[model samples]
Every structure is written in C-alpha cells, then in structure tokens.
Target chain A: MTGRDRSGGTRAWGLTVAVLAALAAMWPLLPDYNQITLARVMVFAIFAIGYNILFGYTGLLSLGHALFFAAGLYAAGLGARDGGLTAVPAFLAGILAGAGLAAGVGALALRTAGVAFMIVTLMFAQAGYLALLYFNEWTRGDEGFNLPAASRTVLGLELAGADMRYGTALALFALATLIATWLARSPLGRVMVAVRENEARAAMLGYDTGRVKLAAVTISGAFSGAAGAAYGLIDGYAGATFASVQYSILPLLWVLVGGAGTVLGPLVGAVFMFYLIDLTSGLTDAYMLVAGAVLVLVTLFAPRGIMGEVRRRVARWLP
Target chain B: MDFGPHLMLAAIEGAVAAAVLALTALGLSLVFGVMRVVNVAHGEFFMLGAVLAWAVAHLVPGPAWAGYLAALVLAPLLVGLLAAAADWVVLKRVQYDPERTIVATIGLLYILQQATLMAYGPEARPVAAPFDARIALPWPEWGPEGLVLTWPWGLGTTAWKLVVIAAAALLVALVFVLVQRSRAGLVMRATQFDRETAQAFGIPVARVFALTFALGAALAAIGGVLVVPIQQAHYLMGGDPLLLSFIVVIIGGLGSLRGTVVAAILIGMSDGIVSVFFSPTLAKILATLLVAFVLIFRPQGLYGTRAA
Candidate 1:
C-alpha cells in the first residue's frame, strides 16, 4: 500500500531467497525419513498457504477445502494411472479439476454468507467423500491407491529417489510461497482484504464482491490443488482419508496457528504442526491428545497464531 | 421381498433412525438457539455416552438386561455433567465466540477421541440390548374376494427397536415439557431471546448456557446409548452422526426445535428408504446435497421463518 511496504517486501524477498538456499543446502544432509517428512510438511504448507487466500484474506472460512485437495489428488492419480497422461499433464489436470470444482462450489455456496457458507461447503465435501467411497472400484475406497512407479517421475526427475522427492517438494513450496507473497501484495489481494474487512463496503465501491470471493476460492484451489497433486505423485498414494473432514480441519488449523493473512504464516504453522505431531507421536500413541491441548492453549493465549503474533509484536510488515 | 413389505421395513427402520436423530438434532438446536455457538465435538459426547455405557455394562456382572438398563439410565447423566464441565473449562473461557468455539470444540474433540483411543482402544465394541424379541409384521394382500393379512419374509423387528422408539419419544416429550413448562426452560428461552437483557434481569445467563450445553449433550448421549445395541461403539463413530445431525439441524433450521425434529424425521426416513432403494453411500450423498441446496435456496429451512 506504500513505499515502506514495498521495501519491506524486498527485505522479505531477500530473506526468502536465503531461506531457500539454506533448505537446498541442507537437503543432502537430512536423513531419508526426515526428507520424506519435510516433503509432507511442504505439501501441507502449500495447502495452508492456498487456504489462507480465502480464509485469511477473503474472510471466508471454508470447512471443505479437502474437496478441492482430494479432487486434485484423484484427478492426477487417475489421469496418470488410467488416462495415460504424463506426470506434468496429470498434475495440471488435478489443478484444473480443483479450480473448476471450487468455482462451481463458490457459485452456489457464495450466495449464503457466514455459517451457512461453512455448512454448505461442509455438506458438499461430505458428498464428495461419499462419492469417493461410492465409486470404490475406481477410488479403491478407504484403502486408496498407488500410482505405478513410472508415474512417479515428474519432468524426468524420479521422485522415487529421496533427494529428488525432497527437492521437488521444496521447489513447489518455493513456487507456492512466491505466488502467495505476490498475491498478498497484488491489487486483487487488497480487494480481497477489503471484502474480508467489509463485504458491503467493498460492494458499495462497485467491486464485484462475489466474483472476488469466487476468484479467491478458485485461486486457493489451484494452490492447494498443486500441493495435492504433488503430494500424491511424490508420496505415491491417493486416498479417501485426504478428503475427509479431518483434512479440511487440518488446513484451517494450520492457517490459524501460522497466522491468518500472513504470506509466510502457513509454512511456519505447517512446520510447527508437523513437528509437534511427529514429536508427540514418538512419545505416545495418543499424540492427538497433546495436539488438542496445544490448540486450546493457542486459541486461549495466542489467538493470532505464531506468525500473526510475530507480525503484531515484532515484524509489522510480515505480510 | 416385495416392494410393499420392503417399503414398510424401510419406514419402520426409518422411524427408529428418526427417533434417534430427533434426540440428537434437538440437542443441537437447543445449544445453537440458546448459546449461539456450534459445538463441533457434540458427536464425541455421543460417542462417550456409548463408550461409557459399554464400560458400565462391562462392570456390572448381571443379566444383559440389567447391565443395559443401568447404562441406559446412567450414561447420559454422566455425559451431561462432563459436557457442562467442558463448557466451564473451555467454552466459557472463550466467551462462546462462534468461530473460536468451533476451534476449541474441535480441540476438545481430539482430546476426547484420543482419550477414548487410549482407554477404550480402537476396536468397535457393542453392548447387548436390554431385551430382544423378534416379532413378525403382517402385510395386507388383496385376495380374489377380500383382503387378507400375510406375513412377509424379513418384515420382523426386534422388541428392543420398539423400545428405542418409545424411549426416544418419551425423552423428546420430557424435553418439550422441560423447555415449555419449566422455570429453567423459561430462563433458557429468555437467554436465547436476548442475552444482555437476560443478564440485566439477573437470569444467570452463563449458567443457562452451561445447562443448555449439557442438556444438548445429554440428548445426544441418550441417542448414543440407544444406538449402541444396534451398532458398535467405535472412536470414529461420531463422524457420521455429526454430519447427519448437522444436515438435520440445518434442514430443520437452526434453533427451531419443531423444525429440527421434522427435518430429522424427513432426513432419517429418506436415509432409510434411499438406502433400501439404492446404495447407502448414495443415500448419504443425496441427503448431504439436499441440506446444501436447502441452505442455499431457502436458508430459513422448512419450518423456519427467519433465515437463521
């Protein structure tokens, strides 16, 4: 919005580049298990970042992003397995499916605001989950399916290798991060925030608030869709569990914990959440007990989440 | 085997489901109406009731009827108290802010689920019905001269299922009496109407909120207790009921008790009939989409006047 914001953006760009460099450098040193976990973290990070566009910026709390994510997963998984598309084409198909679904969902769902929107989206996702189960011959139901080992090769880089897998995930994460930060600073992004702050006011200014919301959701789907596509391809699995309400709640949780409306919050939140679960599960089978307790405490004391808090107290230009 | 008898069986089974759903959805309506907060963990409370009933039944070394009856009586009460405590410890601290409450309750859901997993294990465990007797149902058939009654194959229901229907109706009746006639009901209604004004009148709105939350949970628990004999108690059992009750609550209209029950019956009956007509998953998908369309086209719900 100002010159200061631009310079803040530059500094942020430098910081991101340095961070990426460090991550790239550390890739070879990390163990095989850690590399896989890190890839998962980046995938969730992409999911959260994409989710933030609508939830954090547009102020639309969708409990159905899992539908888009799973749409992407299935689109890619099936395309490569059955449609005989290459890895890139399969991934593109996933993103297109995700965006198309989000646009369709937003068309009807956006008519209702607030809680109605949430419930409508939830029901749609519920339908999607059931659809996945109903078409079990194709989806393999709850058990999910794996792509052929050859299908795992993306752009001639075999994701079967640990380094290639982690590098590809990191590359996707960097792309998502760049796009997210750009969107946050873009004119449409400001309009989205305007809508979030006050939809009536935004509409009064002659902005098509509905379109902006739909756009936000569609773009969000594209982002998370890429994550889902990458995740299925890299992880070699696509399953119904990823389409469940639990998956929907996970992105929301990550966004809230990382700081809503912040470009980098999703990454921080996803990493923190990943490590938190990883560490807790090592000690006990009831890792979710600890996770639940942390959620309560975070909501109680740090409602702004990690990055939201960071933005407030330390980094005024975090976004 | 025939369409008429199959439809009849679906209707009866649907009634059984409607009975349970009404109990669950009514509870949801109360909490949403009075407290104005969505408790995402409501189904977990239901799961707890069934799990607790199983535990209680296991502890009681007696006839199956004796243990089952004890669980039916005790589980809901215990769950209500637990829900009230949760409200005090978690919800009250958050001031019942709608979004925050959702997150907190989700957190509460995880805690409850993980605790159950730790203590109860991941297995689906079932408790026996207090009494079970199969009785054949007669279908009317047109003869050459007159009408005759014929027993249809697979048209029998257990005595316990009828008991569930009766028990649910009685509990629902008790809730109506409590809400419409009792002093606490008046307080709850007052709070629901206007929280600040009720507080000004020294209504102890906070306590009413707690009571409303507890009662909602208890109703869901009763549903769970009744259902446990029919289905096993699993940690993951809460998810479907949660989705179905949400559909009922929305289709019924938020905070509209009559509408909630009506929608519950409508949904439950359709669920049964549709499952019989098609696949169960297809039935669920249709019901879910129905709620979404209902909310989109008529946010007021079937019986609701206001777009709540």
Candidate 2:
C-alpha cells in the first residue's frame, strides 16, 4: 500500500527479451524430454498469462475460462480438420472464438461478483464441457480429435516436426508475454488495476468498471483461446480433456506459482509446475498429490505467489 | 413400456436421485449459510465416504449387511473429523476470506482426489446392499372391471432404494430438528446471522465454524454411504454429484435450507422425466443454464426470499 506501482520505468522490455532469449537458447542444449516439457510449458504459460490479465490485473477470478479456451481449440481444430483452413487461419479463428466467447460469458457472469461470479462461470464451463460430450459425433468428446500433420503445416513447413513445433510454441508464448507486458504498462491496464482494487472509487472517478472487466475478460479469453489453438498445432490434437474443470484450474495454478500479475511469472510458474508434475509422475501415479500439496502450501505461505513475493522484497520495479 | 409406466419409472428413479441430492445440497446450503464459505471439496468428502465404506465393508469378516452397517456408521463420522481438521488447518489460517477460501478448498479438492486415487485404485467398485429385495410395482388401470391392478415388467425397484429415500427423509428431519429446535442450532444460527456479534456475545465462532464444516462433510458422507450400494465408488464419480449439488444450492437460492431441499427434489425428480423426453446431457446443460439465468435475473430463487 505504501510504494504503489508506478509504470514506465523498470526496463521491463529488456527483462522480457532476456527471458525469451534464455528460453530459446536453452532449447538447443536440452534433451528431447526437457524440450517437449518446455514446449508444453510454453503452451500453459500462454494460458496463465491470459488468465493473469483478468485475475491479476482486472481482479476477476473465473472458474470457466476453459469454455473460452475450448471455444478456440475446437474452432481451430475443426476448421483445420473439416473447414480445410490452413493452420494460421485456424489459429486466428481460435483467437476470435476465444475473445468472442469470453465477451459472451463475461457479459452475463459479471452481473454477479465474488463467489457468485465463480459459480456462474463454473456452471457455464461445465455446460460447455457437457455440450462437447453431447456432440461427440463431431467433437469426439473426452477422447478428442486430432489435426493431421498436413493440416498443421504453415506454407509447406510441417509443424509436426519438433523444431518447428517448439519454435512456433515459443513464438506464440513470446507474443503472449509481450501482450501481457504492454497491457500491464498501459493506461487501460491501470484502469483494470483500479477496478480490481476499488471498483467503487474507480466508478466514482467516472470509470466504467463493468466495461473494464468485460474488456479484460475478452482479451484474456483471446489469449487462452490462442493458447488452446497453439496446443492443437504443437500437440497435433485437441481433446475435450482440455476443456474440463482441470484445464481451468491449471492456468490458475501456473499463474499463482510463477507470480500472478508479473509478465514473466506465468512462464516461470508453468515451467515449475510442469516439472513438478513430470518429476513426481515418474516416481508415482499420484502426481497430483504433490501438486495439490504444493498448491495448499503456496496458498498458505505465499499468498502473493512467487513473483508477487519477489516484487515485494527484492525488486519494487517488477512491473 | 407404455407412457404411464415409463413416466412412473422415471419418477421413481428421479425420486431416488432426489433423495441423495437433497441431503448433499442441504449440507452445502448449511455450510454456505453458516460459514459463508463454499467447500469445493465437498464432493471429495462424499467420495471418501463411499471409498471408506467399501474398505470397511471388505475388512469386516461378516455378512454384507454387517459391513454395510459398520460403513454406514463409520464413514460419515471419519469424514466429518477429517473435514474439521481441514477447516482448522487451512480455512482457519486464511481467516475464511471468500476468495482465498475458494483457492484453498480447490487445493483441498485436489489433495483428496489424488489421495483417493492413490488409496482406492481407479476402479468403480460397488458395495453390497444390506437388503435388496426387488419389489415389483403394480399400476392401476381401467379394464373390463372398474379398476384392475397390472404388474409392470421392469417397473420394479429394490427395497434398498426405498430405504435410501426413507433414511434421507429421516436425516433431513433430524437436521431440521437440530437447526431449528436445539440449543446448538441456536448457536449456529447466531453465528450465521452475525459472526462478529456472536463472537462478542461469548459464542465460540471459530469452533462453530469447524463444527459446521464437519457437519456438512458428514452429511455428504452419509449420502455417499447410502448411494454406494446403488452406484459404485470411484474417485471420478464425485464430479457429477458436486456439480449437481452446487447447482441445487444456487438455484435453491443460496443458503436457504428449505429452498435447497425443494430445489433438489424438483431438479432430481424432474431429471429422469426430462431425460426421458430429452438426452440426460441435454438436461444437464439446461439445468446449468437454468441456474445461471436464475442468478442473473432472479437472484432470489423460486422459493427463496433471500437474494443471492
């Protein structure tokens, strides 16, 4: 409360570039297993970044962002699989779908706040998940459907290959990070923070808190949807599993672990959690047991998350 | 089957569903009403109950009825104690802030789920019912005579199903008596009505919260024990009940016990009939949307006067 964040100062762009370069540089030295895990981490990082914009920046916590992510995933997947659109077009469609769905859901869900907001979003997402199952003849339900390697190609460059896949995943993750950083430093971003901190005060000062929330959700949804689309391209498949309540919770976990509201935190969190599960999984079937405990411990000890704590103690210039 | 028998069959199945749902939703309603916190792990507690029942049932070296009886008594109590511990360790630390409570409970949900997956293998194992005499149902229809009783094939339900309904009713009555007519209920109501005021007046608010959390978990566990005989005990099986009960609590007007019971029965009983006319998933979609719209348009539910 004392040292309030003052944007436009912290060499944030340099930090962003440094992180991206480090990710790219590390890809060459890593083994195949780590590379794949790293790629998967980026996919989730993108999701957490988008989620942070709403939860961290805008102060709205949603339990149904999976609906938007799935909307993007299915759109991109089905477009490439059936619509015969190229990968790029499909990905764009995914972004549009994600943003579109978020707008739609946020419009109604934002009517209620706090716990009620969580429940509304959750119900809608659950309904969407059921819809996926109900239309399994097309969506393939829980098993999901695959987009062929040919459909994954961009300008005859096959995305099925590891190098291309990882590169594309990194590129998208970079773009998502840039978007998050820009938003965090932007005036609109400050308005979102204002809404999060004191909506009544922001409203009294002639800000439309509702519109700010809706915009935040829309952008956040687009990022989530884009992540889902990227997953379809990189993983070469899209499944109903990605649209489950678990999917929604994963981004939330990543954002929390890495540092919510920090541009680099989502990626950091995603990397940490992915390894946490990966390493734990090799040892036992109940990987989530450790993950769950981590969540509980983190929530108890690091209420502000890894990045949040860092921002508080080490660097007041995190933004 | 004719429409008459089909409808009746649907009604009976719905009643069975409603019976279990009412108890589960009522538990959720009590927690929300008293503590003003949502227990996302409530379903996991139910799953724990069923799993424990299976363990107890198998461990007891006696008849299926003996195992069933032991499980019926032990499952809920154990689950309640576990819930109380969780409240003390986690919720108490967070001071029951709504948002933090959500996150913490979600973590608790994952812990319980993963633990169950570890302990109880990923099999949907069933518990043997204490008594399951299949009773054939008779429908009345006008024949050559003024009235005739026709036995419907496949219109039969097990006696255990009836017992479930009866037991649910009894438990509901007990809950009502405890909350409305007991000294403890008075304390609980006071805490719910005003937490700070209750604390100021010498009521142990923290202890009340722990007890209420335990009670809610116990109710859900009892529901699981009652259901495991009919359904199966699986770690993943908790999802639907949790979703359904949460919806019931919301639609019943969020923290209204009477409203929760009525909504549970209406939704549960109508589900079979609705699915008869439509697919079950479709019915679920509609129900989910129904709750959202209810919250959106009429935050106060059909029977609830309190605005959500």
The TM-score measured for candidate 2 stands at 0.95
Candidate 2 ranges beyond 4 A from true positions? A1-10, B134-156
Question: Can you list the residue pairs that collide in candidate 1?
Answer: none
Task: Report the C-alpha displacement of residue B271, candidate 1, in angstroms.
Answer: 0.8
Q: Give Cα distance to truth, residue A39, candidate 2, Å.
A: 1.5
lDDT tens readout by residue for model 1, A106-205: 8999999877888889899989999999999989989999887778886677887788889989998988888888888889999999999999999999
- iRMSD for every model: 1.6, 1.2
DockQ comparisons of all candidates to the true complex: 0.68, 0.71
- Candidate 1 Cα deviation (angstroms), residue A123: 0.8
- Error (Å) of candidate 2 at residue A60 is 0.4
Number of the top-ranking candidate, with DockQ as the measure:
2
lDDT of 1 by residue, B36-113 (tens): 888888899889889999999999888988998888889989999999999998899999988788888888999999
Per-residue lDDT for A292 in model 2? 79
